[model samples]
Target: MNRWPLWAVLTPGEPARLERRVRAALMLEGDEEHGKGPSFEVIPGRGRYHAIVGADSSDVGAEFQIAKDLSREVDEPVYAIDRGNDPWAVTSWRKGVLEVLEVDPESLAESLGCLLPGRELPSDSSSKRPLRKVALVEGIRAQEASRALEDAGDPFPPGHYRFEDTPQGLRVSSETGDVGFADITLSERLPDVMAYGVIASPNLDMFFVNVLRGGECIGHFALPPRDDSFVPAVRDIKGENSPERILAALGIPAEWFRNE
Candidate 1:
C-alpha cells in the first residue's frame, strides 16, 4: 500500500518545536481523538523531519486534504512526496506557486527505510487501478443482493458498503447517480423503497452498512474502532427491530440528529 509523505524543514536544533507543530497541525491529542498521527522520522543527513500519513486503501483525497490543511498552519514549506514515478518527486507550494523536485530513488529509499523499519517503499511497478463500478438496487433481499453481487464479481460481502476514491471526492456510484461522501444525508425520514442494497469497497476499515426499508434509511452503521468490538455490536444491532433499538444496541450514548 502507498503512503503519502509529508515533510517540513526543521531548524538545526528544534526537534521539540517540530513535534509541537506536528501535533497541532494533525490535531493529535489523545488515542480516542487522533488514534495515532503520522509516523515521524528525521532524515539521517538532512536535518529535516518527515511524517508519513494516509494509507493507499484510504481515499487519496484525504492525503491531499492533510497537505492542504498543514500548508495553512506552518510557515515552512510543506512537501508532498509523490511515489508514482520511478524516482519519486517532491511537490511543495512556495510563494503561492507549486514547485516539484525530483530525487534519486535508491538514496531516498535508503534514508526512509532506516527511519521506517519494517516498511517497504512503493515499487516503481505500482500503477493506479481502474475505477470500480457497482450497481445499487432497491427491493432486493439480502440473499438476492449477495447473489447479484457475486454474479458481478463484487469483492465485498452482503450488506456492507464503502466509499471509493475519486478525483471529485469519495463517491459511491448507484444506477441513479453518484453519491459523494459530503452529500450523504443521514435522516430518520424514510423513502418509498422496500429494501436497498449497495456494492462498495471491500476494505472493512472503510466499510459501512446502510439498511433502508419503506424507502427510508433505518440503519446506518460504520465499522467502529478495533477496541469497540464492532462485530458483536453489528450482530446485536441487526437483531433489533427499530432504528432506536439498533442505536441502543450500539452502546453509544444517544444524540439528536437532524434530517437532511
Candidate 2:
C-alpha cells in the first residue's frame, strides 16, 4: 500500500467559513451542502467536505463513534485524520480514490477530558510537506499513467493525469502522472481534451489524460461522471500549453511536487 501523508485544518465554529476555505485550497466545484453535519473544509476549494478524525491511541474508537453519530445527520460517511499539526497534510485525494473521512484530534481530546494521561493536546500549527507544482489530472490510471511517461513520452495520455484509486472509487490527489494510483476511466465535457479509462476493477478504477487543450481542462466537465458528450470529441495538438498554464495558475502547492 502507498503511504499517505496526513494533513490537518482548524475546526471552525461556523461551517460556512470552513467550507469557503476548503474550496479555495482544493479548487472543487460542487453544490453539496454540509449543513449541520460534522464536516470540515479543505483548502483550494470550499464546497467539498473532508471530515476530520482521531490521531492518537484510544482516540480511534471515540472518533469512529463521532463519525457514526454524525453520519445520520450528514449526507455521506464520516472519516478520520491524524491531529498532529494545525494545517495537517493528508492524502485527501489520490488520483482515483476519494477520501471520505478524516479524524479530529482536538475534538477527541476535549471529549476525553481528564481521561487522557498526558498534557492536553499540544497547540501547534505547521506543515509537514510544502506545496509544489501539482497537476490535477481529471482522469488516468496511476500505474499506466506513470508507465506512459516513463522515458521520453509524457506520463499521461493526451488529456488525462495519473490518479489514485480506493475501494470506494477514486482517491482525490495532486501528484506526478506516474506515481499516483488513479482510476483511468473518465467522462469529459471539455472542448479539445481527450480522456480515457485505463482500468476498471470491481472496487477500483483508473483513468488518465489522452489529450489536453488551452491549459484549462478541455471544458467544465473535467470533474467526473458527467453524462454530456463532448462536441468534437478530439484533442487539439496546438492546445498543449494549457495544462502547464493551469498548473502555473493554480500555483502548485509545495506538497504536490516531488523531488525526483
Candidate 3:
C-alpha cells in the first residue's frame, strides 16, 4: 500500500493551548451543533501549532507548494508531515527558501497522538548515523555567525559588501567586484600566507585573506574591493589594520587569527 502523507498548517507562538482549542473545536457535543471546522493537534514537545489534514497522495511538490501558499495567506508557518520514509519528514518554506529534514519518527508520532490517537508509530533506524557538526535546519548557523559578527562591532564597511546568514552558510556578496578576474598572491617573507580574490559582482568585490594554521588554510577576513575612484574616507583605510576589527566582529579572539 502506498503510504499516505499527512499535512498541517502551523501558527507560531505557544502551541499547547492552540492544540487544545483545535481538539475542542473538532469534538461534537452529544452529536449536535459542534465539530464545525478542521481538527488540529499538538506535536508533543514541539513548540508550534498544527492542524491535521490527513493524507494526500497527490503530487508531493504540489502539496508542498500549497502548504507554502497557506503559510503566506495566514501569515504563519505551515508544514507537511510524512512518516512514509525511513526517518520520517517535515518540510516548510520561508522567504523563498524551502527547508526539508528527516526527523525522529517516534517523537513525531508522540506529538501526533492527540490527533492520531490509535495510530502506530514508525520504527527508529537512525542509530548508526553519525553526528553532524552543523544542523541541517536552515539559517541556524548563519544566525550564529551574524551574531558573532555583530558583537565584534561591524568591522566590515556596509558600502561594498553584504554578509548574509543563509542555510548553507555565511554568504558574502560584493556589489561592484569583478567576478571574471581574480588576483592571488603568496609571500615568502610572510611564509604560508596567501590572498585570493573571492567574489565579484556588478556592485561588490571581495578577497579571502587566509593564513596557514595547523596545515590548514584558514580564512580570516574578506577584504573589500578596491578601485582608483575612491573617496578620501575609503582611501584612508588600510588592509593591515583590518584583522583585529574583523576578528572582533566575528567574535573570535585576536590570537586565533594569528599563525601559530
Report clashes for each candidate as comma-separated counts.
Answer: 5, 98, 10
Where is model 1 more than 4 Å wrong at Cα? Answer: 1-13, 32-45, 48-77, 82-90, 95-260
Worst 10 contiguous positions by lDDT, candidate 2? 199-208
Q: Which prediction has the highest lDDT against the true structure?
A: 1
Candidate 3, residues 201-220, lDDT tens digits: the string is: 11112222333222222322
Please, what are the lDDT tens digits per residue for candidate 1 over residues 124-223? 2222221122223333333443443345334333434433433322233332222211111211121333222221232212323444443233444443
Off by over 4 Å in 2: 1-18, 23-193, 197-201, 204-212, 218-260
- How many angstroms is residue 41 displaced in model 3 relative to the true structure, after the best TM-score fit? 11
Report the C-alpha displacement of residue 185, candidate 1, in angstroms: 26
Supply the TM-score for candidate 1.
0.32
Best by TM-score: 1
Output the lDDT of residue 212, model 2.
Answer: 30
Deviation in Å, model 1, residue 210 alpha carbon? 19
Better of 1 and 3 by lDDT: 1
lDDT for each candidate structure? 0.34, 0.30, 0.33
